[model samples]
Target: MTKTLLIGGNSAIACALKKNSDREFISLSRSEGSLDLDGDLNELDSIADIDGLVYFPGTINLKPFAMLKEDDFVNDFSVNVLGAVKVLKKVINQLKEADGASVVFISSVAANLGLPYHASISAAKSALEGMSKALAAEYAAAKVCFNVVAPSLTNTPLAGNLLKTERQVEGNEERNPMKQIGSPEQVATTIDFLLNAHKNWITGQVFPVDGGMSNLK
Candidate 1:
């Protein structure tokens, strides 16, 4: 059985994947689930062999650049980049035990596009993407691949505030070329593909699951 470790179990994407995935899942999150590392990566040493890992912890700090503080950037980076690094570093040996291992990181479309009120998240996600690419190259010999999935505004709990009102939803939908907001299931499907061993040839790739928001307009 393929064992997959998922961080941030409460995330909408994680919930969607858990409902549809056939693989054995080990979930870790603050409020619920097991695997309590408590900011200590060494705690992950107790985990069993893992074939796939998906880091789902992220932040959506939307604000004007001028109004953003240094702490905002730091906090975003801490969750988006540093948190991923900690989890991956700890389970790397376990991932190596598998024939082919896959690591997936969640990112935002703002990483590639210049969007207002997304300065902090964009910077953090860009760094996350760069780090994933570097790790993918460094661990290619070990058959531990790394990839990122960038999504635009989606209808998830994490993005609830952004889509709370009808006007807000319509404005975001109109901004996208598809004229519709994305769903957690839509992004979760792509993430599932990347975590599967069938896509062994794919690595260091940033897949945009956005509704043509990153490129079209």
Candidate 2:
């Protein structure tokens, strides 16, 4: 079985992935503030290498551009970008040792489309998408694949506001072309497919797993 590294594995999406993935998975979190990336990746390295890596840190702070705080951008940058870079730097060798592996980044559809109160996340996710493509190209020669999964509003922990009230949930469901809200399991399925060898030829791609929200409307 392939070994995997899942960062921020306590989120709703992470929870689902953890439950479903049959691979040997290592879970990481800074919830207790012990996951300081600069000093160490783990208290003890149980696995010498990783065949798959998925970074799941994200923020759902949606506010009009004028209302967004400066720190908001910093927070998003630290978690979404720097955190992944640190982990990849630490595990790149192990990934190489694995001969060929995959790196997947979670991105938001806001990166490509304009919407109300999505400026902060849009900018950050856009940067992430660009980074993924660059890394994909640079890593291809080594048989490593890197890809981005950009999804629209999904019913996950990060999207609590959309699912808070019954009416809100129903409204969001109707807003999508599928007439239903997307689920973490649905998103995880895509990630699983991307990491498998069947997708060996696929990289430097951004898949919008938005149930047609990004294209239909």
Candidate 3:
């Protein structure tokens, strides 16, 4: 069985991915133990070879331009960008050892689409996308693939505040070309595809699972 490391594995999408795939998943979540994103990641030392990795840590800090503070951007970047960098540094060797490994990072449609109250998250996710592409180029020779999955607003715990009421949900749905909200399964399916390292020749790409929100109307 292919072993996949799921950073922040307790997330809704990660759980959905685990349920839908036959690959073995090893999760490290802060809610479950001492996995702190801003701190040391010594927990990865004992792990052996891993064929795939998915970084699921993210934030949805929404506030007006005026209301946004420096700390807000720092916090969002810490979770969305720095955490992925830290985890990747720790696990790159394991992935390279597999000879055919894939790494997936979760981004947001807000990174490309200019949405209100998404400045901080957008900045962080945009940085993440750039980093993923760069890593894809750097690791291509080693057969280690790196890609990103950028999804729009989904009904997950991390987005509960924005989707708390029917009016809010409806407004969000109406904004999308599909006139619907994304689901964990929808995004998970995309991540699963990218996780299949040796099966596909795709790399240095950002697959948007945002129901056409990033491109269409």
Number of the top candidate by lDDT?
3
Tens digits of per-residue lDDT for model 2, 1-217: 5678888777777788878877777877656233356654764265666888888887776898899999888777777788888888878877777768988899997889788898887888888889988988888888788888988788886788768999998888888888888888989888887877425688889998998888896
Per-model CA lDDT versus the true structure: 0.86, 0.80, 0.87
Error of 1 at 4 (Å): 0.4
By TM-score, the best candidate is 3
Model 1 agreement with the true structure over 1-217: per-residue lDDT tens digits: 7788888877899999999878788887854222344565555677777899999988889998899999989888888888887788788887877888999999999998988899999999999999999999998878889999999999998899999999999998898899999999999999999996325588899999998887785
- After superposition, the stretches of candidate 1 with alpha carbons farther than 4 Å from their true spots are 31-43, 197-199
TM-scores for candidates 1 onward, in order: 0.93, 0.91, 0.95
Q: Which ten residues in a row have the lowest lDDT in candidate 3?
A: 31-40
**Tens digit of per-residue lDDT, candidate 3, span 7-44:** 98899999999999888898988653233654536767
CA RMSD per model (angstroms): 2.6, 2.2, 2.0
Query: Sorted by TM-score, highest first, which candidate order results?
Result: 3, 1, 2
Please identify which of the two predictions, 2 or 3, would achieve the higher lDDT against the true structure: 3
